[model samples]
Target: MTELHIRAATPEDLDTVLAFWKVAAEGTSISDDSGGVERLVARDPEALILAERGGELAGTVIAGFDGWRCHLYRLAVHPDHRRQGIASALLAAAEERFVRLGGRRADAMVLTRNETAHQAWGAAGYGPEEQWRRWVKPLTDQVCSAARPDCSG
Candidate 1:
């Protein structure tokens, strides 16, 4: 395995970052979106760290922190770059960043079917929340309008 230098992603690296997600064979909900990549870079480059092996993008992980808890998502290592410790390194960096910002804990939402991701998260000190499960539902414009009222949220 080559030395993977983890660093903040830049606009120039968006293509490679999105490309990695594009070629992922299976096991994630990340889409190949150019607009989304640029939006992330505009918000916080550190949240979208890129792993490079001798200047080539090998892996990426999007770590978002909301002042209290850190959320890790979109962790994707190129198929060719799997098993090289890149994902682990990226995770370590994310935790460090979260702790530095006074975060209490880190969280990640992996697909229930992705055993590989489950193992990686477990090895990184994340355990399955048998007592709790984070649930989310996408809201469309119609749903959003239906839920809105003159004095209610």
Candidate 2:
């Protein structure tokens, strides 16, 4: 087992990270594109953390702290790199970042059907807040506005 190195991602890593998500991540996100990720890196460079082993991207976690709350997203470990403590390492790093940022509690967005992810997140001491439900509304994009009459702006 090679030593794993964890570091914040840079602009040069945006394309590779996007491609890696397609292969390693469980699901897609609205902000998965190059532009969205580039904006994230531009806004907060240390939010996207990457784990590398032997020069290959083994895992990634987005540890975002927005003043008031800490959010974890896109925790993906490559299939070939599973069971190698990469996820744990990534979570530890994320937690440390949150603590540094004065965050009280950290929350993660895990898909309902991803049982494997459930197990991994549970193992990391994060449990689902079943009492609360998530509600989301996508801000209108140009195509959406053109297609839907209700889409304002």
lDDT per residue for candidate 2 within 1-153, as digits (tens), equals 889999999999999999999899876776878888999999999999999999999999999999999999999999999989999999999999999999999999998878999999999999999899877667645332334432211
Model 1 spans > 4 angstroms off: 25-32, 140-153
In candidate 1, what are the lDDT values of residues 45-85, reduced to their tens digit? 77888788987888888888867678888787888888888
Instruction: Write down the worst ten-residue block by lDDT for model 2.
Output: 144-153
What is the TM-score (0 to 1) of candidate 1? 0.82
Provide the TM-score for each candidate, comma-separated: 0.82, 0.92
Question: Best-fitting candidate, measured by TM-score?
Answer: 2
Please give the range of 10 consecutive residues that has the lowest summed lDDT in model 1: 144-153
